[model samples]
Target: MVNRWASGSLAQRGQANRLSHGAAIMPVLLIVGGGLFGSQAAAYARSRGIEARVFDASLEGAASPAAAGLFKEAWAGKRLAEHYRRAIPVLDRLYGIRGVTLKNDDGEDESFQCVPPSAILEKKPVLAKVTAVGDGWLETESQRHEGWVYIAAGIWCQQFLPELAISGKAGAAFAFPGEQPGTIHAIAPGRQAIAFVRDPGFTHFSDGTAERDYAQEHEQATLSRAAALGLTDTPVMRFWGYRPYTPGGPVFRRIGERTWLATGGRKMGTIVGASFACRLVENELRA
Candidate 1:
């Protein structure tokens, strides 16, 4: 199956209206990033009647591709999980399941797999296994782990949206020290385990023409924090990606009149981004 959307008919139906209303006729909705969220948003929008475009720099700082790609359930919370459950059918239809092997936090080896309808009748059934974390489990006995697949965000986003945004940031990932289990790591809301400060004069990637070196500063700060967290020896892998920075709260805003800002998922960008896109189309773009 080509991993493309199936809503061309819907687009055809809306063609006349799109041509009629220029303001609402976003001949193309412009997306500013090419990470997982950006790519998925473009896909979901195109599947609807809306034309979507993505602009990406494919910079070293882009975070999605470098992410561990773990879709831990805890991140979804209650409301987001409901939204996710509602969106699952669409996601399953657009991108089906795959097989994977996962090691849970309890050091138990398990099978994780995405079972599309085609495998429903198979003899070997996929089963879920409980791990140390109350909500943690690995998809065992299918093919492989259920979650965590590479989306090729850079290529997929551009191939689907074919637009670009020129901004970047630095992000990093590190394996927990061997002493720790491979379960989901949870950080309490508003809890500051490590100390750091955003430069008093930090600039949003879209703000101004700015050139500042924060890489060393970031690395040193991260290392110091990791040391405090007792993971000093863990290897740190870095990535560059931009997330909307909002101290008040995360939001999806319309800048000026045409440009829309759908950024800032923090760590859950991929999960929430797709859901947000679906809602954006149904509520904002659908005619």
Candidate 2:
């Protein structure tokens, strides 16, 4: 196979394998949809071996490339943060996955890293259960890795809510390629987070849509944006529909008989999304 994502991380041990075998391999029911919450949750099911099928409306709606597979802890609140923190182990164990390109499902990762990334592993918790934790390609003591977290591309949330609501004022995003060579940069920062990237500049087919080209442009623009904002290298990503804005933030609900949904708010759903999937699995299995 061409490899959708990449081979499992050795540091993750057999966690990915176990997630697929233990969580997905078992008898389970699956429901797939769009919206940041549903799309990532469905992808989590697949990573866990749930073989959760997807129902995508368009190509870009389901966007995570290889980079999407990376995980992070860049959310908004404590409860949400803890919730994702709780979901990591379930994700770590879900190591063995195929059918990946450089990007997430949406074909974006190759624009970032080519080979499957190397992870620095750790101990993560699934509620009271301790599980293996695999960080992303980038290594740091903090879980908040400022990179992409591949989870079946941009996620399929847009399907359910085609007009995904955003908070920022409506504004047009302009595209620019860079000096580094491959990356493409499109910035449309606003008061809140109303930036609609699903329809990023390159949504339509283009001739020179190479990753290196886009990277060069993005890198240069990123440098300028950083300096203008008077900040060090800060974190910015596909914070579309429902991306967290708090230290421990995410989608959750304790209202009904017992149903909750959580994914990393930012694009780092790999770790955060997996963490939530584990909780969902545990609840289903335990129930």
Among all candidates shown, the one with the greatest lDDT: 1
Question: What are the runs in model 1 whose C-alpha is more than 4 Å off?
Answer: 1-26, 97-101, 109-170, 174-245, 255-258
TM, every model: 0.48, 0.36
User: Candidates' lDDT values, in order?
Assistant: 0.40, 0.31
User: Per-residue lDDT for 50-158 in model 2, tens only?
Assistant: 5443322333322222122322344324544665566555544444332322222233543221111122111121112101112222222332111112222232322
Candidate 1 backbone overlaps, count = 22
RMSD per model, one decimal? 16.9, 17.5
Question: Which model scores highest in TM-score?
Answer: 1
Q: Write the per-residue lDDT of candidate 1 for residues 183-283, one digit (tens) a residue.
A: 22213452122111111221001111112244666556555555554455645333344443333333455322223445545545555565666666666
Model 2: ten consecutive residues of lowest lDDT = 124-133
